[model samples]
Target: MFCPHKNSYLQLVCAVNPRIINKAVDQAMQREHFDPHTELPPAQRLESMQPSLYAPHVDITRAQLGFGRIGLRLINRALHSHDNLVQLQALHSVLDQVQISENAMFLINLQLIYRIIDLMLDQDPIIKEKVCLILSRLATYYQGRRRIMSRPVIVENLMRLIMRDRKEIRYAASYTLKTLARDRCACKIIMQNEQVVEDLLKMVKSDHTGIVVLHLATLTNLAEWDLTRALKANAFQIMLTLFENKDPRIVSGAMNCMSQLCKHDVGKVLADDYDLTFVLRRFLKSSQIEVIISATGLMCYTTLTTRSKWRAKESCNELTKLLVNLCCTPNLPLLQIRCMQVLINLCDSPDIRHHMKVYWEKKVKTINVRTHEEWDGTSETSSYGLETAHNYRTMCIEKVETIKNDFGDNAQVVNVHSYLRRIREVKEHLLQAINWKSYKN
Candidate 1:
């Protein structure tokens, strides 16, 4: 193809003739299905389709031979083409032949990515799939990840893709962002990007597998920017919801990210903003141990930070109870270490220290009685000399008095009694395990 310039008549030539290109593509397609992952012809048969790289020596247009401008033009033309297949082919060619330098980003040619993004509005499932792959590849590309992020238009495009009704596209975009956010600088760029947080927040309720993954990825990246503040801003609710997902990886990632985000100056603010005492109360009983552990660690850290910055309040006592309960659970040394660290940090406050110790003492007594009952083959009722067991035994008897004074008994008692029961059980289990070891000696 030739676009004539001046009297010099700049000649532009495509390496592959159109007819042969089609024929070769057809044969390649017949041999193997079209795979977007395959950048070029199959590696085994590269010898037959030895493609040459083209760098124009003479000015094809008005300006010098800048690789950036040429790449944009090629990418744009590929995006605008009415044929999806042709667009795919063009995208493949650009990704294959374009020489991206170190530290440079795909944003250098943002317009092309924008052009492809515009096509996302189309309803074709196949095209959307290809677009997902293209966006994903661009996001993960060494320099390309940064390049795509630099342009607001590209972020808008990605946000739109993420919000798409299709699950596959949503997952693809989420996965792409997750990969990109692995880079610390890239995460900061994403956090500062226009509407990234808002768009991500909206994805919180999405049922798609990819969107959930994407939400965690986006929050993970945002936390890296200023984890404490980012989470306090609104990620807490979404992260809490993600904690409900069955995928262990997502649960683990969300927990770890939430933990890091809560480690900053606003850590206490985040805990208070989310009213984590209530949230963790529920998460403590989560079926997934990883979720339980992470939730526990986050609570411990949040309480530790809040004690230092915020005014002393009953909230600290609630946090103490939560941590003491966590300490009563059995787990990896790392989790116990974190729980212990929380205990040490919280020790600075006499009230928290006392409250935690009281909770620990009660937990120990409960465990000791239960173990004797179990070993003696005596029922709990007879062993404890109680006619009836009541729920909410772990709840601070002082909690209701405080609430009654603060908000009158008219305030409906949030039935946190269940959480208390679970925590008591966890404490008993840990205590039993530890006591068994001492008796053996």
Candidate 2:
């Protein structure tokens, strides 16, 4: 077996008393008749664990002990003690070990998962706050997430805690939920639980940016799966109202949620009614890159339809130029790509197409060397997909045309001339591949 005494992760736990640490672990190992990983059977199980109605497997073993199983076992026993100081020490020790996968499995084997969750109900707010933090840290791993999701009491407890007056604990509980909400299954659970949704929505007036961000982020995750509850909960207006908050974090979170909320027709209708395009347009100038990116995402929705495109234009005359500015920086690939997509959508409106061809290209075409978005017509199911399927013919035409236009052109040309040539080549191939002359003639 690996020596726990030498491993750095175990130093804090062993520091309490090296002898005690070894004794707990040695006693566990000496029980040769029992599997250290498995717990007592139904009738003989701890009353607390049996009530959970599920047999929790703790993966503690000699191999994983180096990850801090000894500390976890001691902490588990100490948490059940009536003494507050002992519980606090155990909780602090857990903070160090719970981050490890092996520690989480040991925690389950010790049947300590239920007790940690139960600790959330402790009358002392500090204990409850620490409990929420432990849960939060536990949730950052796959093993921890699996264990947490298995306990239904967690969601209810967190929801109730968010409603309480203790700000620190409320934020911690919401923080734990924010981590859980990132998982698809967790999103489903939150959406299905009407009380959870209601509780999150009621926290709309929270002054704490941390709690607000967590709640909004959690709701945003749920909205991505289904916009129904977001619609029913009035998420559109709630996000808009929260946008007025001075905190960029809060505004960005709301904008992200707004992006998902507007994916459905009903949500879009509400956005249009509220003149959201103007609001988004105003945020385009935000100093925070996060707010700008979120605004750009929401702006895409505004160009999804004929009416919305004009509305987007009305709110900001330099929509294409502003979008091009976002594309100027390749450092933010997502923002750059999203800005280009918004330009593509805006080009759906005939008048805006000229702005894209002239202003957009002049401003940022070099930033985007090649694109699949400028009408590839790759859809074969379009009823007439064969018109541009001849690749060899198009390539031959492209080379022939470039050679003809190259007339005195040399590799010595400046970067600008070369850049313009590339742009011209893209447009020429785009038209040639589609057999532009055949259709026009």
Candidate 3:
């Protein structure tokens, strides 16, 4: 039994039976209904029903209910409310409903971005943290990122928050900054501020792995825009330090940042100062596929850089083993391709080529012996066993024949010599793909 004026009835309920209204609001805000598919509790359901009575006239209902303008008004009012509890509740309410597209659009349209940034200065750490969370959600979209970046003071405020002693505030600020850095213009704006880079470097040096991961991600995006700045800030060395961190997430983020840095000849820096070959070889054992992939990629770049060749050659045995294992491993196409590229680069050195040849020869022989044993045993057994043995033999024969084609008539040398030629051809094709000019020294 609801009144004709739904908003008025709700307001009347709030005034007359404030406890009942608060209880209903509390139930509605419970975490159980957080999922979209979950049904609300009966009281919350009743509150939701009050809005449906006027749903037939959608636009008129939205306007008359003031869901658009009033929600923002409430937030504004609560933001400036004298009571800290009221301020926290108001911000939390806006945050709770932010997942709804209409409410998010309303907040964005009302230009609450600036107001939320101002709220970041709230003396209460909880209020500051909540505001940062709101900003993080808002920065998830392109328009929000553009709007947030429009005001330079907002970026400065975020940087200040990043340096705050409170881990929660620093984390929220770092996350929001990471999201904002996704936009090219926003990334440029962030990188232009020298203190942002400095503050990020300081965080990287801090003992906190979680905060370090976020700052590393933000720096990764920033590095993508300007590798020189990243290098100047000693990002490469910092990432190298993170590589040794025990946390897999921090290690992965560092690897990703190193990979991006290597894209701009920062590999030269990695090659010169760090034992990248040893580092990458160690990473080959990582259980994480992403870490393995990133390591392989940086290994490829490090080996390709002129100064790193000596180090690459020194790790020829390890590199060759890594490549062979990746090649034989099933279901990892990306890792296989990247390993192959690095293998091709390493093949330029005679020592690496020799090591690879020995490695392949050993693999071929091992497979050949196994196939022969199976063939011998299958002849006196069932038809099924014979068929299996025949298939195995055929596969081995094809592999040997493929090697023979490249190495000519010498079967003993075929595996290694053929592999050398194949890798050279792959390198040539890769160079041609990128239209790289060859210089005669």
Candidate 4:
């Protein structure tokens, strides 16, 4: 039975029954009688998996031989005890077991989840701290996230606590919610609470860089679905302020959030009004790879207009060199692909095209042209291969020709736009060439 007042999915998700949900929640969390390792083969069809899909990942037979079962049972009992000390110790013990991941899996149940949610509002600061800690630990696991995200009370409380709680509690609560925010379904539930969205936007401006980073990470998730919520919250201005901070993490976080926010015409108008193109250009010089990637991603959208294009052309020398360097670097094919994309987008201006030609003639930068033929293991190839960057040089060369040959002296962007399609096609073909399935497996 569902709550009568809550008709929509958001209301349904955020609506909690306090003590328990219907029998469905109980049935979903029920433990299988047999060992999961023995019963369920590893899910080979990885692409078909849903966000909240729970796969039995442990060997219960081995777990029963060890103290894993007993430890979890004791923690569960202690958390339900009348004494506060017992509850505190049990919460701490949960934190320890959660590090092993599988042990944490044993501890998640409907009763304990709601009980912990209730305990989260305890008057004792220490108890509140422990409650947040336990929740944070539980939230790290897939099973824990599914349960916690299902109950939107945790999201509301975490946002409230982050604003009013002490440093440690705030951090703990932020960690839990940020972990849960990884689920898009959970993020939609969060968007339903306008106050929670506003609180996150407010928290992103916290003086504490660590707090700012965690909250910004959470905001990034919220931005993926409800960009308008953040846009109306004047998140763009807050992001610009955050970009002024010297901490690479803060700047990168702001840039990443802005990357999502700039998806719409409204966000783009804000960027043009705030001069975000100039803001991101400075970050291209950052030594941090994350900062560079985030800045470049923002650039992908921000540089779409004639004004931003002209602005970017002002620094086309540095842009060209950076794009060229990134494309030549093996093992960083993903970054290379992004670099190629930005480079192609930059070509919308003939001034930039002429500038690139003049700069290339003065200093022709090249890499191992055969980088496509072999994996150098130079740029973190363990997770990816150089396949995508195989034709990277060729793409750049064709781009050069597109710019120079399409409309030599008085080239129209209309023709160049048609020419740029081939570059994107190459990117698409090279993207498919990547053995992403093998890498993920």
The candidate scoring highest on TM-score is 2
Tens-digit lDDT string for candidate 2 (34-109): 3322232212333333221111221231112233456557668878889676676677677667776777667766
- Ten-residue stretch with the least lDDT total in model 3: 55-64
Model 2 clashing residue pairs (backbone): 58-109
361: Cα error in model 4, Å:
8.3
Which residue ranges in model 4 land beyond 4 Å of their true spot? 1-71, 361-441
Query: For model 1, what is the alpha-carbon lDDT of residue 394?
Result: 22
Q: Write the per-residue lDDT of candidate 4 for residues 201-320, one digit (tens) a residue.
A: 777776477888888888888888888888898888888888889888888889888988999889988888777777776677777776777787788888787788878777777777
Please identify which of the two predictions, 1 or 2, would achieve the higher lDDT against the true structure. Answer: 2
Please report how far candidate 1 places residue 305 from its true position, in Å.
4.9
lDDT of 3 by residue, 74-118 (tens): 776566777666666677777776677777877787787877788
lDDT of 1: 0.55
**Residue range with the least summed lDDT across 10 consecutive positions in model 1:** 1-10
- Each candidate's clash count: 5, 1, 0, 0
lDDT of each: 0.55, 0.67, 0.66, 0.66
**Residue-by-residue lDDT tens digits, candidate 1, 1-441:** 221221112232554433355446667668656433233333233332332222234223122223655655555565677765556555555444344433124433555566656666666554565555666666655556655666646555667777765666667667767766666677666666656776776776665654675576567666766654565457666666776677765776577667766677665666666666565656666666566666667766676654342443456665556555655543232344455555556555556555555556555454221221222322113212533433221222345668778899796453334333444555444444333322353
Query: How well does each candidate superpose onto the true structure, as a TM-score?
Result: 0.48, 0.68, 0.65, 0.67
Model 2 stretches astray by more than 4 angstroms: 1-68, 368-441
Give the winner by TM-score: 1 or 4.
4
